[model samples]
Target: MDLRVSLQALMGRSLTRAAVAASVAAGLALTGACGGGGAGGDDSLTVGLLLPGGGASRFGQFDRPLIERKLKELCPHCPAAFAATPDPAVQRQQLESMITRGVDVLIIAAVDPELLRPSVEAAHRAGIPVVAYDRLAQGPIAGYVTFDGAKVGRLQGEGLLKAMGAKARGGQIVMMNGATTDPNADWFKRGALSVLKGKVKIGKSYDTVGWRPENAFVNMKGAVAALGAGNIDGVLAANDSLAGAAVSALNATEVRPLPPITGQDADLAAVRRIVRGDQYMTVYKPYKPAADAAVEMAIALGRGKSVESIATGTVDNATTKDIPAVLLPSVSVTVGNIKDTLVKDGMYTIAQICPPQLRSACDKAGLT
Candidate 1:
């Protein structure tokens, strides 16, 4: 199938629970029967899952549950221990704690890859395989699963340029980027620059601290102060959180015409913002495939099997080279295609996105 079609299908409504359970039962049993160290006979196996906290809400709302459910379905007797915290130090401690508990395998979404390097290395030394999820943790990780970071940025950049229209030639845009500690942040910046550089004037740019909306708010306020709100024709916000902040700052200054803003994560609020014309676009990356890949990789590694079957490709990180990976695609969402994208994908229903106050806006956008 075409890549775009496949991505659309992946992002659409997930498989039913009954279907998933049936597949897991048959497939995993077959895997073990093939003598590839499948999940069978691993009654005492333990998997450690570490996430980067609930900042995005997707982690807790979708990824964690999907991963846990898949793990249980695939390996009926294997138990999983989960940990999530916003602080990098806390994440490191959690890694250490998991290590001390002697987990068979670990799936970690590091808050800061560099700071978590030592912990990952220690896990490697302890013979515990680590699967990097979302953000690639710098270490000898066995597998990695996430969406294409650069593609995500390119989508944002393209959306911003399109929204700017005739103003694109000399448009001034403020860039509200994610935390510098994230490797994906660097990739996103590079991809965005590939489209934005030379084409538009970057009035102000900031590396948002901690990926927090409040920090983005402060940074955006600083940008507006430095560039003058009128001078900024557009804003390139790395994610929904930053986009919301940029919009908030613009509102505070009471800019007559709100500049078009680009965002990612297709967050519920951001989608609502897009529908309301407060923001331009966002990138939607389905969580099911990513979480599902991580679970499969974790279980396979824990069973002393290779993840060659699950990994779609390989990626080289700062400390590791040619690591197995599965990089999913992302879709750009705009008001024009809200139904085709988010609603069709079942990411959100019309009712959820269109509250009573937004009813008119939803109808106007053909979302009703």
Candidate 2:
């Protein structure tokens, strides 16, 4: 099969296929040779995949396996090593080690993109092309794969407003944003603000440090105290982890009439929360295409082939301009589409989400 045709078929949507195949026609020939321990041009490529910590669960549970499996399928002997941690410095060290080990390509989901710049630059200096995964790292990135961050935020904001109904205008809501270090977090905040700034009163807003649930819990508690439980009508949590924290704070404070909360990542627990009427909605980014693209890009880069064929568009990073990228679309998952979205996608089974204790909620939502 033509690499270009295979790349197009890897994704589900025709629009995505069209966007990705545009540049493939120009870069059809494979140029790299195979031999040796280094990226000094060889197919014996060692691909290093560095992911952000297991806080979100998706990185380890889905992205890692999917990328590894796809790499095996694409290149039989090409080895892929993986690592993850919450600390930025630790991740940077890991990247440096991968570079020292002479991996041909590096795919990184930066723990802190800004702090990780030096290591990424080191990889570039060592002639190893780095592919920024999920979050756009600040460096000379050759390729990137992620869903539209701003769009994800817009979905969350729009869902929150719809859930709030008429109370959205005068109602007060807390904004629980992700860590400032993450570029995507800012994108999400900007997108959410685009929709929410004029429509509702932002009673209290916080940039959750480290994207940590404990930090979010503390921030939510402070928001409730500063704004008063009654004044707050909703919460715009950047992701499911933060949403869970906000819900915990609300429940612990015994706040009357829990407000609608928005989340991203569509975590299993978050989906369950939606079924139990605790969370309003979550943005479901299909993991397959993103992971598959990363692997395909890695293999291609390892084989000394251009990734223009795989990347749908070009994105500018802090230090790089016109970096090839694959930006996937995100879907809004609410109780209404739990069956069609998560279940249909095989992300989770009804039995997994609807526990025996929550059988009644599941029945009401028709998840049985």
Candidate 3:
């Protein structure tokens, strides 16, 4: 298939189909040696993986394993080192340690993009190419892979409006945005505001510290008290974590009928919440294509080759222009299409999403 055609096909496809297409593209890039200029076909490159969170977080539960699996499949002889931390300082130290250890390349989903700029530059100075994964890190990055932030937010915004129905007309809502440290949060907020502004009243807005659910919980509690749970008609939460927090705060404050809430990262908990009529919807960005793209870019860069063959697009960061990038598409998931989206895509099984506790709800949603 023509590369242009292949890239176009990747958009709007189911998770399983897109992943297969991406794998085929990777294979074509490898066999054709499209941009071979460095140590060609060197499979012994060492890769260091850094993530923002672990232990039940999306990074730990999905991305880390997916990246590792793709790396092994692409470069079986390569040794891969991994680390995860939510602290910016700790992540910087981990990056420096990897630099000292002389990993051939690095893949990092930075906790704080600005804070990690210096370290990313240092890695560049050390001749180690960095592949920014999920989160766009600052400095000289070889390539980037993530879902389109603006589109994700737009989906959340549109979903919230649809859920609100009659309430959307002049109704008040709380905006539970993610931490400012992450640029994607700002991107998502902007995209959502583009759709939400002038349509509904934003009564209360918060930039959740550390993107922590606890902070979100506190902010949500304050919003409930100030806005009056009865008056608040909707919530525009940045991700599933914050959405969960918002729901908890509303429940705690004795908000009888939960308002429509928006979320990203179609987490299992968030999906369950959707089934149970807690969260309105979630944005599901398939992890496999993202992981495969990152791994493909990292290997190509590690071998001192160009990523032109693997990268389907380009993105500009604070310190770099025209950086090779692969921004994948995302899906909007709700109770109405859980089986068609998440279950059919194999992100979760019917049984896993519709546990015994949610049996009745699942049946009503047609999950059975």
What residue runs in model 2 are displaced by over 4 Å at the alpha carbon? 1-43
lDDT of 2 at 152: 86
lDDT per residue as tens, model 3, 40-155? 34855778888888779999899988888887788877767777788887787778776766778889999998899999999999898999998889989998887888888899
* Colliding pairs, model 3: none
Worst 10 residues of 2 by lDDT: 1-10
Arranged by TM-score, best first = 3, 2, 1
RMSD values, in order shown = 8.6, 9.4, 8.9
Q: Which pairs clash in the backbone of model 1?
A: none
lDDT (CA) per prediction = 0.81, 0.82, 0.84
Candidate 2: the clashing residue pairs are 34-43
Quote the positional error of residue 318 for candidate 2 in Å: 1.6
TM-score of each: 0.88, 0.89, 0.90
Clashes of each: 0, 1, 0
- Name the regions of candidate 3 deviating beyond 4 angstroms: 1-41
lDDT (10s digit) by residue, model 1, range 53-133: 644577877788888888878876777777777778767777777676677888999999989999999999988899999
Model 2, range 1-368, lDDT digits (tens) per residue? Answer: 00011122223221012332323222211122333355534447778888885434878778877777777777766777666777787677777766666778888999899899998988889888889999988889898888888788899889999999998887889999999888888889988999998899998889999999999999999998898888888999999999999999999998978899999988999999999999999999999889888888877877778988888777787678777788888999999999999999999999999999899999999997
Candidate number with greatest lDDT: 3
- Candidates 2 and 3 compared: the better one by lDDT is 3
